[model samples]
Target: MIDYRKATVPVWTLATGDVRVPALAGDGPMTAERLAELRSVLAALADEPIATLEVHPLPEKLDSGRGIPLDAASPLAQHLSQLITQSARSSSTAAKATAAGEGLYRMVVPAKVAAQLGQGIVRPMAAKGAAGGIRGAFVNSTTGRIAAGATFVPAGQAAAAGAVGGAGATAGVAVGGSAALTVAAPLVLMAIAVGMSAHADSKRQQAIEHITELLEQLHEQKLEDEHSELDGCRDAIDKATAILLDQGKLGVSLGLDSAVHAINTALGAADRRLARWQSALDKLPDGEAVEIGTLTKSFPGVDDHGGTFRTHLELAALAIALKRRVNVLQAVEHAQSDPGNLFESFVRALKRDQQRLDELESSIAGVLERLSALELARPNGLRPVFTTGEVDRLMSAAHRIRKLGDGVSANSRTTDLAIEIARDKDGSVVVFPALPASA
Candidate 1:
């Protein structure tokens, strides 16, 4: 198991002579007020890409030298095709050419059910798909891949000339488009930076940026730890799709009296995540352009450069202490959209995009896991203080979409998906025997 608990988010400073030094949170764990300040930042992170001030982690390359850069056009082509298919669905020539893989795909439900769902009236656990609303938007209408994301460094260890952190560093491990930085004697470096930031000269935005950076850092760290779990998830999706396709090849009854748009639309997106995850896993061998595991956490204590700076920063202590002062921000995200129809809202917004929600869900779970680790490893320990209720609100908000709870309720959506194709004539669902274990 990857030890997600071992790493921390890197904090840095803009040092003298235009150079960068790893920074520590000068303030203590975020207070409720400070946490409140993160409302907008959290919302932005959930929806947008990292706000990197500069090109910090300089891109590296392939050892074989016959590599396709991940950010290049080749990777994007798959995504482009998905978009074109949607608009051209009405043309039967296009539909006939590719019954399974091409044209506008949809999930056909009864008009009554569609109306009920459109009215925010889904059955229990239907909320699982709702979380996919914003995340779904991140999908490439063409490729259906997720563009979800994550950062670090240490002391004494020197860094690359243009590394994303201060001077001392180690080679970064890339995960998708993002990367991580490592450094020497983290304790010493963090202490020096934290106190320096407290001198009453820092702007509020800097603090906000600090938390945003931590969120990104946490995201990358999770990818490092859960790569295998993610890969397995992707593989499962592929197997399921294969089965569905195998059945499709035998020409099961297809002409149902239903709204073609709804059925195809949902089906088109149902397994998009499968493709998205596969695409990301495919890049694992090429950990360049981005790095992972470089985020170095700090405290008010000691490290390599010298004795502990002003204080001891650790699981017991922290950077900003968020107090949930910005609890309202999370609501801002949902409120800005449809008032009641969360599921319908998500489907409409995401119909054109590729897969991305799973990544975002992973990110929130990663942070929560880290926090839980801290609580477990050292009860009453001084962990990074989120004074604001950002984490709290964030946790609550994340949970809203991240899960629908344990057992059958959580799996109802998946069950419904299976029933979509395999229901029996008696009106009750049928259970197909498992495909060969080798499959």
Candidate 2:
């Protein structure tokens, strides 16, 4: 079993001049295979004297290589030195052979001396030689690659000038010229390219950062808005609740139990609406884009905001039923107190009205139960059931019940007054047999 927690990797920096490339960090100890992979990457670069800036053993906890400076003694430094040296030798020889003008002369340089010059600076000189002309090339002892482009005079010319001093002096001048070109011309071009690349990379990173910040800000603003909306909704619900409570208290004061119950039913309906609102808001994602259509299409629409809305409507219908029932109860109470023929006729009408009210209540209850079940399966908002015509019909029924109750009350009052008048008139009449008991 690999203990992933215990394993650690080091970060390495590959730098060329002032522009530092991104550092690489990965797991596990350094190996020859990994070093070869890094070499392959470096080899692809056309320029030379490319320095592996430094390699550092990163702290175990920090994954990011940012801000952590490279260390000199790391394994990456050794691997880079080896690769650069090998590259410089190969490139330098190629540069010299290719630039060997009209005629070629066998040029020999001691391997030990070449190696002593170091890899870092030499590799670039060899590359320069290859870029400039086929000639004996200069090499950096630090990084063993041909200079980016060498400025050496032709090897054929240098061979001819051997008479002027010696072979050594002529070769030295040629090498010096190559080194100058490597340092001066090619280095400048490489610097410019690196700078442009770095600038472009920096801009890309900035754009990404800006986008991330904007998204975060939008999310926070949305949350604040939702909270404010929820508070406002709660206040509306509380106000409606207070109105229902006040109505109930008024009914109680007037000894109207039926009215009180109707008001209470209305309050319950309001409570259900409040719950539906809460659930709707809860089911929504925190952001602005709440995909309501997508939600409805999935899962047969049984367990969504739609069902909650239907539940609210069902509760409201219950209040309407209670209101109808209250009207019928008031009419029955009035009819029982009457005694005249007109009152009896009104009572019969009221009985028929009470039956109609009962049917309406039962119908409303059935609708509510169906709606509740639908909502439980998939909560949805209620479709409006009462159009203007439906509302007018309900009102008309209520009006008829009220008119019958009023007629019964009026007839009962008239009958009582007539009976009282008759008794008074009879008493006022003269009596011939007064005092018969005394005789």
Candidate 3:
């Protein structure tokens, strides 16, 4: 067992022809040259028990009985300075070791004594004794004060020990060796997993393209079907209009009003469907490309060999325009039910409805022109192309229908005397005039 009180003071003794200083006591600050002198003097006095010296006040006389100047510039100071310079060089080397991931054991010392020491010092013998099991060193830079605990090791040494074992077996192992391989395996596997996930995402994007193409095809087909249905309805209105006009000219009437109403109703239905198709077309995703030829070919009953059917289609389109005019006239009559501000509302509604009908009529004319051009481009042997005159006839008929609608619109504006009489307050009580006198 060690005595704690004995460890606290800086007293050196000689034994076995060598000087031994207490590790804890010498750990205090002292000049390198002074420490070396003390060690040399003690070494010369081997086996001698030296008195405990007070380091605070230097003596006026020494072992040689000569006055020794303690001033930093004196000869004695110069000798101390050389020893201090050597100690400083040694301390610098130790500091470098510490800086290179080495641990430090700080030994606190008084500042004034450290200045007189001329150099920082670490007693190797004291460091070895104080560090029981931990590896470290004792550092001193003072002459009069006691030092504290000094054992230390590199800060990373403990963590390195945990990596291997408490025995520190793997501390010297290189980073890229088998030990590193064990850590890298999981990271490599994780990278491969991420790459495969990215590939799968790319495939999903491709599939989306395929699905969008399919949707586009379906939408085009729906449009063709709607166009065909509208064509058929237009044809029916044309036949009815022709029959009614003939009946009216013959004074037969043939309930022409009802036939006109039927034609108008059919045209209204077609207009509503066209509006719906336009809405759906507008809603399609932007930049969606479709094959124009595929869309035209998808129409049922489109003859590839003769192409004569296209002219019939053109005529059908013209009929739809005429039917639309009839519908507008009927709409104006219906709006006449509200006689209040009737003229103002009627004129506005008529102009708007007439504009829409004109636009549809223009579209019909454009389609007819395209069909005619397509026919002209074909070989002459294809069934005789419908005469341009037939298209002109259809247009003339549409113009007549428009004129008839305009006439009906004008008639609706004229206030009926019967209506005026019916609206009179005393209309129910008809008063008979006095009997006329005979001449």
Candidate 4:
């Protein structure tokens, strides 16, 4: 749905294979490249069992067509601001980065490690009394360790390090493909990689199935997008796709305006369907009493037992959506919840998931809502960028994917598409920027 040619990509971190450039610590505002460097530097310091967070400080009243300046205003910014102030004061040394080093990253670790490092900092490292306003800083929570920042600064390098410190408060900001306005730090990128790697070994077979189905569906939709029933619809989808890609926050969204709403509706359907399964279980003599493992063990001639077993399989298939929502939650918390507890923990997770869903729905809805509210106050070219038909396509694609049912759906299909996606977990059938021919 997007035009990759017109959009810019957010600066990739070293870990994500960011392009290396000569140190331009000063002589410029904090452009995308400088942020890439600072992100890379912090990543190397504590790559494992540690989380790195990039901090970007924006100028007053700056707006990009893409949603960056707003994304920077997330709670993450406030957290980073406080953490940096604390770290700058507590540590004798921090990064020698100037304002150009505005992309400085902070490493997260256990509290004890941070204490050992003594007020580890993640701010622009001007001298203690060096000139310039603070770019940004983040203090560690008592538990999340703030390490590596202080160590990067040496005994007498603050002034040189702080050279670009003045530019740290730079107002010039631009986003790359799909970066819209979320936290585009390498730390979050690394987290996505690490989180995906954490799927259960037991679910490997399921993951394979899901990935296969996802690839097929994505391929089909890509073809559809390339050849929409209406040229107007296709063009709108392309622009919307660009917005999603350029925003870079949400990945592989179905190019539908009401896409999020449809997803929520499906989640609601799945929940209700799960309730039916629960009702069926109550009819069985040993249904609720049975553990998760024996869900398939049928009793002699109990004709109805087969239905219960099928329900088990149904829940197993729908697990991908459940897994995805949970993963997003984990990323935000910066902690992993027990995987084994997915079903058992689902009840506990229900409220939290609903709350999270509401917030997401609101955020996404706000974009459209504001666009509607303003009537003509469109900024960053978002007005013509979104379209109702695209919303329809996004919703349609999501529905088609659901019909191919992962966990639970009313539609039943006999093809491999059904079996494959219903059992897989690698990802959902939705494609963000649309998949490649090979995928």
Stretches of candidate 4 off by over 4 Å are 1-208, 211-254, 286-439
lDDT digits (tens) for residues 218-325 of candidate 2: 444533332233223322222322222112112333434534444454545455544554455456555443232433332222232223333333333333333322
Estimate, for each residue in 39-60, the C-alpha lDDT of model 1 and write its tens digit. 2232233221111101011112
| Candidate number of the best TM-score | 4
What TM-score against the true fold does each predicted structure earn? 0.16, 0.17, 0.20, 0.25
RMSD (Å) of each candidate, 1 decimal: 28.8, 46.4, 50.3, 23.8
Mind giving the per-residue lDDT tens digits that candidate 3 earns over 1-439? Answer: 2222233222211111112333322333334335434444432332321111111111122121111112233221222122222222434433333232211111121222111111111111111234311111121223212223322211110111111111111212123211211111111111111111222222223333333343344445543443444334433433433332112121223343554454455456545544543454345344543222322332322223113233233333333444433443333343334333322333344445445544554443443333222211122345676578655644543343233222111111111000000001111111111000000
Task: State how far residue 23 of model 1 sits from its true place (Å).
Answer: 73
Q: Rate the local accuracy (lDDT) of all candidates.
A: 0.22, 0.26, 0.27, 0.27
Regions more than 4 Å wrong, model 2: 1-307, 340-439
lDDT of 4 by residue, 34-57 (tens): 443543444344322122233222
Cα lDDT over the full model 2: 0.26
